[model samples]
Target chain A: MSFEKVEHALHKRRKSRNIGLGAVLIGFVALVFVLTIAKVVDEGDAQRAEQALRINPPKASE
Target chain B: MSDASLNTTTQDGDAGFGDFFALLKPRVMSLVVFTALVGLLAAPVPVNPIVAFASILFIAVGGGASGALNMWWDADIDRIMKRTQSRPIPAGRLSEGDALGLGATLSVFAVVMLFLASNIVAAGLLAFTIFFYVVIYTMWLKRWTPQNIVIGGAAGAFPPMIGWAVATGGISIESVLMFTIVFMWTPPHFWALALFMKSDYRDAGVPMLTVTHGRTSTRKHILVYTLLLAPIAIGTAFTSIGGPVYLAAAVVLNALFIKGAITIWRRDETQAEADGYRTEKRFFALSLVYLFAHFLAILAEAGLGQFGLGGWA
Candidate 1:
């Protein structure tokens, strides 16, 4: 293959890879966001559950 | 064209500390650290803050070690693929021998120190994580089958469980849920990237979804995984570390994730090509946030618990 043809092919390959990487990076950000939100909310509820159990403990069987 | 000529040419490049560090794949390391920290904090058992810090640091080092080993093994394909070509070994910044040495040293140090500082179970889990990532994922499964990431993702999912083990000295339902969230999330997250980067895997001779199964099958797989992931992500709300706040976050984030997956599924290849890969791009980005938000919500719930508020046990 000619030098120019090889260069063109390399360029095309890089472009495709770039698109794929971009997609991957974006997906990573989305997953991080979802996880972060869940982390924050779960922590909150855990605190409340701790309090609720302390204040209004479960009843024992008669 | 000889091997000597190729080696000589490759050896001419610079290989500094920065280059050596690049082999660790810091982006992936950060995710490992964050999830592991969440697991440590969310556990019902109390751990000394100093010990907790050390455990997390060791876990991060172990994760980095795994990445280096992966780079060492995949150097050949990394050289061929555009995306991985700039990695330390592939870019000729570091030799494969050096990567292997560094990865091996860190792996041993991380495991031994984790065992001393925490417990045997956590140490064993860390060791298995390194072995799984290096042996099962990188060397064995990667080239052999398209299901590589799906199964090998267990290595990535182990950190949080390891962290929980460190805190509690054993696995629990909460830790398992943490593991499950990442396990189910991996396929769709990776497949989205594979969809747009199909040619790289093709060039590298790796059997990724886009290469082995075709783009249509890959897209359908992403949607299917996302469908399963949405429920699991929401189900964490019912656990000991879960409550109303987490449930709310799960509902919203999962809705967005499902919508993104549907958008990806509905788009034809021609449209994807014409739009310069927008749908796949959006879904991939959302997947990152999807994971981070889940962990951050857990942290938030934990913090609220300290103040005698929120609804978790």
Candidate 2:
């Protein structure tokens, strides 16, 4: 292969490597961020539920 | 014009995702994200997880946009400086036009999205931060003043305040204190680097403290700023985020930081060079830990308060 052909091939390979790495990074960040928000929502809902039962009681049947 | 010419013409386009990301200055972006996260968590109000996540994400984007624009404008000086010469623009990995376009696009996206997710106050702060870093610090102060890092440090210092505003919907004394911690810390941190890398600034004609005021003056300035930073950092403990744990950490860290600054102040170029700038480099590295630990301490305090185990009794 000629020098030009080799150089072009290397550049293409490098671009592919970069794209792979970028995908992994963005994916990891998004996953962690979503998990954090889920944890917050779950905890907040539990806390509110506990408070609701404490603040109000059901009437007993005659 | 053969096939070789076509390949050569497309060389700049050969830049990949990494090149564009490098334009964002990921390392700096990470620091911005971490500090902003701490600020959000430490606030007095409760923030929804999704809201907090979106706010931090947009803030990080705004921070990254600032970095891109900084690289765009500083491409000239960056080409001259050894420490920054390999950045995408200077290394010919990407074109300056591409960097500017990326910065501008991200800046608008971040600000507009932050407003939708958070509030006008948080979004306004983010917008100002982008404008300050890009227009004020990078374009104007960087090339014009020897005190560039001193005043320009405000750009980095705004993150925590923006983070605070995201939750609180306004500014407060606590947020201002956080801002001051970073602001006061900036000079000593950067002056240490400038001490060792004076030649870079001199060659680039950037007028850093070491370049304009000379090393003697820079050393003195570092000590002065360190002294100022200690009280503000320690004083943070007495506020809503303050507690024994943070106070203890602050005392110890500031003592060490102050001692390091004094060491930098007392030594001459001969002593510094004799040891291969080991002292200056140590101070520079320590400055990073110093800032990181202070913010961490604040988080610890907030964490403790969550369970009735921390802060002023």
Candidate 3:
């Protein structure tokens, strides 16, 4: 037995479109991940500095 | 896979990826990206590189969303105008619904993302820009008045301010000056194109200056705007973002720009037709370079500022 395959312009364009959309979605996820990490790290550093300042008040305040 | 499936796809008029992208008006998006980046970098406050990149991305997406929305609303006139007939909506490559959906979704997405990545000020400006471009300009002013682009130009001018806000978290004189330069440049740039593409606005009934005011008046308008633009652009040189390098570039660019405008102002229809609006065409081309070089000079000044050699000490 033999099998036949078919191709069309529409299929090629549709495939490309799917791939493009997939790439964009993946990029968006990665960007959001990085942004979240940056924000969390920033907040953590700020909190740590605040705690340190409380434990050792500034000489100016004294 | 099947003949029936192929028939259905063709019948449904499904678009390719490029068709979807075309709805965003990538050329205009590029201008948005450049101006916004310049604005952000020129501000005194420093931004985290990651945050800056994300903010700029959202701003560009917002601008593209507005472009898509504009296409959705102007599909009819777009089909009539020779210049816009090939655009996605008008060309039947994408439906108006597709543009509307994409624009609205991206508008919301960009605003929310910008707020998360930067401050509220930048996000607010982005929201306003999308509204101004889509509702105020496209839906309201474009067809209602000959001075459409004059007011509509504000929509394009906001990016730099938004960019500045992203960095500084507030508005300032420098950002306003940056905004003013683009605001003033738009009239002459667009009117020059209107001069040569004479019948487009008329045929589409959009009330462009050239259509409603006549070519002579359009020429005069271009000259007036160009004259007004020179002082603002040159005046930017004295601002915080401006330096000696910027001043030099502004002086030379403004001089050439004004001369081009004068040559355009002096022409009659007969002369214009004889040379096929060559002067007008050149003026239009120069307008693009004029705006780009101005922002580029500002960027260069900002770069030099890092080395302590930029602004006047």
lDDT of 1 by residue, B163-249 (tens): 999999999888999999999999999999988886899988889988988888888888899899888889989988888889999
Angstrom error of the Cα, residue B86, model 3: value is: 1.5
Candidate 1 lDDT at B109 equals: 84
Query: Across residues B162-183, which tens digit of lDDT does each residue of candidate 2 receive?
Result: 9999999999999999999999
> Which residue pairs in candidate 2 have backbone atoms (N, alpha carbon, C) closer than 3 angstroms, thus clashing?
B237-B242, B243-B311
Q: lDDT per residue, candidate 1, A1-62, as tens digits? A: 65432333334434554665577459646644654565466579889999999999999999
Report DockQ per prediction, comma-separated. 0.03, 0.16, 0.49
After TM-score superposition, what is the CA distance of residue B201 in candidate 3 from its true location, in Å? Answer: 1.0
Candidates 1 and 2 compared by DockQ, better number: 2
Q: Model 1 residue B241 lDDT?
A: 88
Off by over 4 Å in 2: A1-7, A10-62, B1-10
**Model 3 spans > 4 angstroms off:** A48-62, B1-13
In candidate 3, position B113 carries an lDDT of 97
How far residue B150's Cα lies from its native spot in candidate 2, in Å, is 0.6
Proportion of true contacts reproduced by candidate 3: 0.42
Q: Give one digit per residue, the lDDT tens place, for model 3 in B144-248.
A: 999889999999999999999999999999999999999999999999998899889899898898888788898889889989989999988998999899999
